[model samples]
Target chain A: MGGSFTVNHLIYLLQGMMWTVVLSALAFALGGVAGFGVMLMRTARTRLLRQISFVYVQLIQGTPLLIVLFVVYFGLGVVGIELPPLLAAGVSLMVYSSAFLGEIWRGCVEAVPRTQWEASECLALTRWQTLVDVILPQAARIATPPTVGFLVQVMKSTSLASVVGFVELTRAAQVVNNSLFTPFLVFGIAGVLYFALCYPLSRWSRSLERKLNVGRRQAA
Target chain B: MKYNFDFASLQEYWPEFLRGALMTLEMTVIACVFGLVIGVLCAIGRRGKRKWLATLCGAYVEIVRNTPYLIQIFFIFFGLASAGLKLPIFAAAVLTMVFNVGAYTAEIVRAGMDTIHPGQIEAAEALGLSTPQIYWDVILRPSLERVYPSLSGQFVLMMLSSSVTSQISAEELTGVANSVQSESFRSFETFIVVAVLYFGMAMMLKFAFHLFGQAIFPRRRRLGTPL
Candidate 1:
């Protein structure tokens, strides 16, 4: 309690920030793949596939992310499966991000004009071929900003991993604050670090939207 | 590889979960009311002619938007205590939520305001409407109506996030589940029940908002148009 805020605490926070980025990267990579599968199922030709994916999305979205974390961490601990905090946090975030990313990408894919699908169909291309060649390429442009924005969200959410004993940025701050007894300084610095990470992405998303929208406006 | 599940052990704690859910609902309702009041003022300020006022509002919105809600809660609940401005757990949770949702609501309402044609404001002024009258009738009402769906959706999201307040032991739904799980040793079962309750609450709020919207915006309801 007598220790003052020092360079050591800052170094610890930076390391925690590093883990936040790592966890966010891991979640985004895994979630992106699973989200792609979800998007495909959502837009699938079969009604059952669409319905199943729709309910999955709804279930995940309707619940709190924190509860999802709890279920993965403490809830699963009841079973024989023992997960490290890092793995538990990563998996829950993956599940959370996948549902959201799937929905966002689905919207982008559907935004691709109906005529593009028909045009590809007229060319005697297979459905998979049309999707890979024509649909996804176009959808990628619209998805870029939101996907980047979601990256920020993923990073911010990694803070909650601290609850599961993961030593990410927020958790690190809490640890430092506990020892130093300076909650305002510790958390304020943590907030600044978060801003440094996220503000760029937010600005980038905004500018990308403007740039993309401007091009379409000029074309029209 | 087999584990026995016992949800029945938690039946005695029904009152705890019920109280927690009610507490969450009460916090959300308070947050909604105060958040909208703050949000409207901030939105109007940001778009107004006063440069400093607009900048201040913009900064508030951006800072809250950029940070994690968990840290914000910690800062408000624990951080402020160090500065000797101690608040009750309930007050701190509700305050942080109001601060959090106000920023989001400001952006949404601002977007709605941007969509209103300028001619409508001028026409309202010409009809002998005073400044407050013009804003209430021609600006805020329509903007709020237009953004009602997004506003309600944000509010529902707020309801779910109220679970985070349980960390400070506000004894909301998640907090109740935490206590019950430790007591009953049925962690998975406790959270399973809690998640379903959250889902139900979300649906209920959405339905309530829809009815409220219909009552308020009869024009949209009668026209069969989406907001």
Candidate 2:
């Protein structure tokens, strides 16, 4: 049966791992930008904008990412916009992560005290100026750990692309196991590689949470 | 670019959809109960005096938390089957969910336990409660009550994420969608309708957990507030 898993299979899995990282970076970058806009809309002055953003978040968050992938991958095909597996996965992951990241960053922004905004306004700064120059900087500090933490979620999520025929680590393992009938070895290696990729990010997130002494605001 | 959506044809598949939805709910219910039991035990183990027990529980949490559910399912369904510990497909999928959710619940429960003030424990100690009694009355009860909101939310999330169990060909909502799409060749309509069904089921799970929470936590009913 094609002799057991060989060095070539390991190499292929490594290649798949590379693509997993690429897709994760792509999703996080695109999602982060879109998430910023969502955060702004969520924390906007107008109640309508905040409500609209809330609904968008709820809709995306409520649906499983698998359904999101299916809708993006196949639903767009119905409209004559066919996307390749990588692009489809990338787009869907971006949609999923943007909702989560937006909610996370919104919490960070809301964590900033009301006095800072008022103080900035008293200093004659416009609302946009205060947001850009004052508020966001503070929120960015609090957002670091969770943002890095969500990166692990982004990486694990890239595995779903395999369902759409994108040969990431999980898909590579599946192909190898199909031929060699050694699901344990193949999938075990893939799981360990994912753990290696995610574990450090998780540790960093935890350490950041410890380091960010929020006592200044915790008491507030 | 003229695509027609024949959801009307799906009228005949209504039974399939309902069956699929109910199956998903069943798995979620089973997973939630077993997972929380495992989670609570692990949480207590991590905080207990046994050195190796805490380490083993810690390792379990880290491994499950770090790995993706997709791989975890593949490992259990196929990997363990290859190792001759074969299980039914539904059992394998739900087992994987219990394992995965148990780790997450352990973390959340641990956090909730940490939030209990030391003063509260001292007060309980002064009342002469034994160790087991202290754990049940002073520690686990209040920590669980404190984290009920997040715990219930996690169960709701487990319902949504359980869609992955369809990979093992479990007759859950997503698996039903797969078969229906193949039969109807109305892939777009099939997926869109199934997605809406999933969203609806997610809401249903959340609401059900909410009501269940209200019923179980009597203090909440009396105080009209979280513990």
Candidate 3:
């Protein structure tokens, strides 16, 4: 508490923030691909597939991401497999994000008009082809806002990785606090950094949602 | 590689586990109840015709919404200590939770309120309803009925996020697990058991919220659909 904040500490925090961004991108990219599969399954013709995928979403959504991080980080070791915390944390985050992203994407896809599906059916397109050619383009527009919003959630959630001893931003703040004994200052700065990362995305998501609603109204 | 796993060590800790589970539920329900009240009030405050008041409420919502709950907990638990108001960890945890969820609930409730038509308020006024009566009958009740699902979901999430309070050693389910794991040297097993418990608790909360919604919004149950 005696010494002022130094460039060294700021650099450490910045490096930690970089990992935060990298982990977020990793989670989003991997989760995006996985969620796409989940979205397909959720709306698949097979009732069982939809039910199973729905269960998947519910199971993942119900549990806290912190617990998921713990299970992956520690449970894997119980089976005599040792992995780096980064890999485990990243995988868990990806899995967790996929379920939520899947749900969001499903909503967006469903929001696309039934007429579009009928039109594709009249054109003799297969369900897969109809989804790919007709429905997805419209769903993509509707999906952007929630997707961005989910990214903020993903970023904030990655802080849970700290509990599993992953040295991300939150963990870095904790480490610095231990040294400086400045709980308020250290965590406050960390919180502000998180706010910096999330606030713009939140604003963008809200604006996109509003704009999309306006577009839907104009089209109507 | 061959590995031996034993959940037996954790099984004996079930009493503690039950107590912890109950604590988690208590914290969540209490926070949800109080937070909902705060949220509705703030939402109403935001809708009030005062520019500065609205701006202040807006800022509160934005700040609380943006920051992580972990930070908010620290700000409450530790921040108040520096200000010479030393509160217990449980109280601090609940307060932080109330403060956190209140803002979120405010925004969601505000969205619900926004959907109420002007005609309804006009009708209430035309009936010579007092301001409080109109607010109660026309605005708040219908608005809450509309957003009941979202509010219930948020409450369930608050229950799940309550696990993070264990970081500050509030003696909740996860905190109990942390202690049991350290004592039993069964970190992985302890966490797995606790994770299952959390999953179970979440399911229970979902069911409870559904029941509560049905009880509160009987019309919804009768109509079998949202308005």
Candidate 4:
């Protein structure tokens, strides 16, 4: 009834923003490491390995992130692990992000072209060296735009962590709204903050995409 | 680790589960239909003669695409309530989904539209096709046929994202799962069931879209080939 929108509310939101950044960084770092293994497994010479990795991607890409969060948060408790909400959310996001990043990097590797693989083989380079020296560097350039775009998805998805009681931006807004009953002002500012964080990345992604298209056209 | 998992407590909640699943399906279908219309219109808006219309549509797409669905839902559900324009929860959820998916569909549809060769439109005109006739027979139908796979993929994603509506307590599958889990204290089991149900729903959606594509584009169906 009294003034629900106050300076204190804004500060609380800023604190929530910090957690959003922290969670995003954590998921990226962990997901990146795991995704590397998945990417390698996907491209390895063995059909069995590639098949397994493909199944992993399908399983993840088929399901919702919210279910993954719930499974990790609640499923772990059933197994006698009473972890904090942050830890649970982190683990779930890492798993979720890994599947997507794996698929993305797989495309990047395959896009390096068959000729590059054969040429590297002609050099008598070992499988590891060829991939490490030649394939990855080329794939990296192609990967930049999609990878950056996926980061936007990662950041937006941190909102899901709030469902597990991890107090990030969206959750903070919900909390403030409960107290203030001024849902519009509270949620609108939260949405604007999310837009502020995401809009630049979206622009960068589109620009990168355009530049890459130009590069491809010139090559053609 | 020793474990005992039971789904028995959730068994009696079948009615709620079914109701929620139907609601989820309804929400998805409603959103997908309206979203596709909005998307195609926006795609045309972006490509047609007016610069301002293109800019306006571009802004709408970017704003919706950049933000999270949860935030969008909150804005429509809670933001509108504060403005004293409260709709029913289901309507609010559907409206949010329509807005959210419309932007994404616009981008995809625009990509489809881009793949239309300039020669095709000219050929249609050469045949004495009216502007509306040319747009329908030449531009829209073929472009949609070419991008049907991507459009279907987007719809699957939309159905998956519909799970977020549970946050607003809209009686969807996830919302029902939440209630059942709390009542049964079988949180893990309940989620596992809901997850599997969602996977099933996704497959069903894909199959339905495939059939729909076949029925709508009978030429492609007769050829047994996608556009």
Q: Which candidate gets the maximum DockQ versus the true structure?
A: 2
lDDT of 2 by residue, A124-201 (tens): 999999999999999998999999999999999899999999999999989988999888788899999999999999
Write one digit per residue (lDDT tens) for candidate 4, span B1-227: 78888878788988988898899999999999999999999999999899999999999998888788998998889888888998999999999999999999999889888878888888888989998898777889888887888899999999889999999898899999999888889999999989888888988889999999889977663321433
Tell me how each candidate scores on DockQ against the true complex: 0.76, 0.80, 0.66, 0.70
List candidate 1 segments past 4 Å from native. B125-128, B221-227
Query: TM-score of chain B only, all predictions?
Result: 0.95, 0.94, 0.95, 0.94
Q: How would the docking of model 2 be graded?
A: medium
lDDT score, residue A41, model 1? Answer: 95
Give the winner by lDDT: 3 or 4: 4
Query: Which scores greater on lDDT, model 2 or model 4?
Result: 2
- Model 1: per-residue Cα lDDT over A1-220, one tens digit each: 7689889899999999999989999999999999999999999999999999999898888899999999888767877789999999999999999999999999999999999999999999999999999999999999998998898889888888999899999999999988888888899999999999999989999899889999889989
Cα error of candidate 2 at position B109, Å? 0.7
Worst 10 residues of 4 chain A by lDDT: A1-10
Candidate 2, residues B180-219: lDDT per residue as tens digits? 9889888888888988888888788788878888788876
Candidate 2 wrong stretches, greater than 4 Å? A214-220, B221-227
Tens-digit lDDT track for model 4 on A180-212?
A: 888778888998888888889988998998999
Backbone clashes, candidate 1:
0
Sum up the clashes in candidate 4. 0
What's the candidate order when arranged by decreasing DockQ?
2, 1, 4, 3
TM-scores of the candidates in the order shown: 0.96, 0.96, 0.95, 0.94
**Model 4, residue B114: C-alpha shift (Å):** 2.0
Q: What are the Cα lDDT values of the candidates?
A: 0.91, 0.90, 0.88, 0.89
